[model samples]
Target: MREYLADISRETEVWTADVPTHMIHFNGDRFLGPHS
Candidate 1:
């Protein structure tokens, strides 16, 4: 999946968690990064 994402766009951000689950956020009007 990482390779595919990278191929799409270099600006794409890829993050992986210790668990099997993951999340992604695209350009939006609001903040998409992790929050407190």
Candidate 2:
């Protein structure tokens, strides 16, 4: 599932949870980070 997400991430926006109160947005248009 992880690899699958990474593969399709090239075209769409993917969001994953890093912690109870943190979120990560993966995309090709910008950098990485904990948006909140």
Candidate 3:
């Protein structure tokens, strides 16, 4: 869980422009895949 959250935080930092709203969703979708 910590690793996942850390990765998410790192990804969010890299894509700070559209953080929570856009990039987070895209990142989650990309990492977790369609089924998740």
Candidate 4:
């Protein structure tokens, strides 16, 4: 369970770093249906 949690945390970190560039390149707001 601890290892699994660690993996999830690592993935979240990577996603945080990558999401903005992905959103800019792919127009993520359109797919996400607008932030409120």
- The Cα RMSD of model 4 versus the native structure comes to 9.6
Candidate 3 Cα lDDT to native? 0.44
The number of clashing residue pairs in each candidate reads 0, 0, 0, 0
- Cα RMSD of all models vs. native, in order, equals 5.0, 6.6, 8.1, 9.6
Please give, for residues 1-36, the per-residue lDDT of candidate 3 as tens digits: 333465564445332333444433435445556764
lDDT of 4 by residue, 1-36 (tens): 323344453323222234444322233454556666
In model 3, what is the error at residue 7, expressed in angstroms?
16
Alpha carbon RMSD to native, model 3? 8.1
Question: With candidate 1 superimposed using the best TM-score fit, by how many Å does residue 25's alpha carbon deviate from the native?
Answer: 5.4
* TM-score of each model, in listed order: 0.26, 0.26, 0.19, 0.21
C-alpha lDDT of all candidate models, in order: 0.51, 0.57, 0.44, 0.37
Give the 10-residue window scoring lowest on summed lDDT in candidate 3: 13-22
Candidate 3 vs candidate 4: the TM-score winner is: 4
- The predicted structure with the larger lDDT, 3 or 4, is 3
TM-score of predicted structure 4: 0.21
